[model samples]
Target: MDDSSPPEPTGDGHYERLSLPGSEFSPLDALVALVRERGLFVLVAGGVVLLGTAYALAAPSRYTATSTVVREAQSEPEGIPSTLPSIPGLNIDPGNAGRTGLAPSAYPNLLTSREVRLAVARDTFYFPETGRRTTFVKHVNQSPGAVELLIDYTVRLPWTLMEGLGRLFRDADRRLGASGARSPLLAPSEEEQRALDALEKKVSASTQGTGALGGESGLMVVSTTAADPTLAARLNASFIEHLRRRVREIRTQNTMEHLKFVRQRLAEAGRELERAEDSLAQFLERNRSVIAGGGAPTLSFRRDRLQRQVRFKEQLYGQLQKKLTQTRLRLQRQQPVITVAEQPTPPPEPSAPNRSLIIVLSVLLGGAAGAAAVYFRSVLASAEAQESGREKLEEIRGSLTAEEIVQGVREELGRT
Candidate 1:
């Protein structure tokens, strides 16, 4: 009959509930409970934080050096636009000018390409931890550092296992590849190509605008990272140098080959011109009397022919020499497909092992772990309390999802 008292159980159906005063829920009380039982949470959190600290300490520092490259950009040459057809109606095409287009967008790929990479490797020496006669490819893949070694092994373990499993599905593929089947889509690359693949992982490239008008606004950025700062800088520079050289070769290859041919002809012409001069001299000496008598038309004709031959040879040689000079200039001018805006310098400090960032992240991670543990324990405690209350206490009706809220309500009521 009284509102505060427990109702008697009905004999026909329902289970009887024990009356409980001040047994309710709220967030503040749940928080108090968590604080009271924070030991496990603290331990878990501390362990996580400790692990993060250890990882930070064990992680090796990495130095990053960047090389800024500016694309040469496109512009009309000094003379006529040879690329543009002289016909009455046709669009201009720079690629038709017999020079490879120096496109900025393609620089990233060219810089990291196997050809440029291998060329760089061939020219450069290995950087001894301090900073190589060996191929740059071999030099770049030197063994990992202690920390790096640990990480590589640890990280690669699962991948290694997965690779083995993957191979099971590709047995037929392996056989086909081994048999050298000519599939256009899936041809195998050379070992050097695979080496370039690895080298590419260490190198990165990007582009920016130079604020210039027209199609030449692209500024390329190429960067590389390594354990040693000097090595990073040197490798980046080497890659750029080789990339430039490669681009120049590609653009001027035809002209250079033609120039070589011209030079050979020029050499032959020089010999012919010398021989003609000597023969003409001998003929003039032998025909001295005939020339004075003005009766030797054949001798005169012979002398005239030799003089013409000498002049023709000299003219040919001059033209070839001029052509060779022009081609050399063209090659020199086209060599700056990608100019170094800024060379890589040995970084003063390591880029990785970011200590402050590690510390902050570690604390956040630890705090999250602690919070999760607290929440889990809080839920478990609530479940147990609910079970016990079901057995020995009366249920209160406030809200269907008000179990925790009721518990907090009880705590405040008891305190008052």
Candidate 2:
């Protein structure tokens, strides 16, 4: 029962573990064990650290550029006060009282939408790597570096094999009279799609300080990442520009159509008014003496009818003129104005691949891995010293297979 005595071996092919109090545990023994296997520990730890350092140096640098914008917030109009007496002819449009323009909350989604991305993809940018200005599509489809090519081929190996097999089967089926379906008309070409995908991954948007109690704050930040700092800044700026254009178009689309309609009607009304005036003038001139003489009741009646028609046309034209003015005002009000709070500038330093942090984490991880390996080796050696433990260990080694090891690795990666 002495504190330094080892625990007795149990019948279950394991040593008995005593439930010692916290004060009885000593860290010095663990330190001594690690020092005893210093050679193995240094080999594992040093190798891991070297690999991490190499990765830190070899990884590509990424720069993130950001632009901030503040959108004008529209609030609902107040209803008529109870103290004010309602007028019989005065009317208020309920639709006009509420916000009809683009909402601030939708800025992030709009920036990330397919339309904006496609528009950005069509823009030309300067790529430092190629030392030439080219469209985004061409840049995305450019030749890959040796390392990139290797990674791309390795990652896509399974998919490539599957696709080949699929084509073979499909050809056989075609010979058996199974026809393939037609491709969709709206699908994009492979090059264009690659550019769009690249934009989707690199460009992003977020909102900040959205009002108290879940209200919209109207502040937005758009960001883009690229290998080159200037390119990153350019991409960020392009996203903001296209996003503004799209927002304005969507906000004023209905109002612009309405304005066009109103103008057409106003023009028609003016023509109708002019025709009525001409008919009245001609009728008066043709029967000037007769009208002055008041001799023919029929002629006087015709003059009166023509005069009334002219007055009616004048009134219609006036109403349409007022409607045209009101529509112009509404269109102006519905237009969205995005104010740029902060312009994107070329980043002075890379925003990714923090080498120092990577090195620190690598060191910690390597040391921990080394410690675990040392402890496991010691325990394993002790277990092999006994007859029952040797037999049990042999059984375990015999039971393990390559397939199970691969499955276990896959499961661990999935969890990670």
Best by lDDT: 2
Q: Per-residue alpha-carbon lDDT of model 2 for 1-416, expressed as tens digits?
A: 76566556678755432222235545764575577678779988988898789878878899999988886664422332212232222243323422245677888998998788888888999999889999998988888888777755775578657756765665566456534653322344557666776789898887786565135656788889999999999999999999888887775676676677767877877888899999999998899997798799999989899998888778777766665666666555543467788999999999999999889988998999898877777667656767877899997886588876777788889952
lDDT for model 1, on a 0 to 1 scale? Answer: 0.66
List per-prediction Cα lDDT, in the order shown. Answer: 0.66, 0.75
Candidate 2 at 57: error in angstroms? 1.1
RMSD, candidate 1, Å: 14.3
**What's the TM-score of every candidate structure?**
0.59, 0.66
TM-score of 2: 0.66
Worst 10 residues of 2 by lDDT: 80-89
TM-score of 1: 0.59
Q: Pick the candidate with the highest TM-score.
A: 2
Residue 219 lDDT, candidate 2, scale 0-100: 77
Q: Which tens-of-lDDT digit does each residue in 237-269 have in candidate 1?
A: 888888887777777786676556656766877
Tell me the spans in candidate 1 whose CA falls farther than 4 Å from its real position: 1-25, 74-95, 121-124, 127-136, 139-150, 153-156, 159-194, 254-335, 385-416
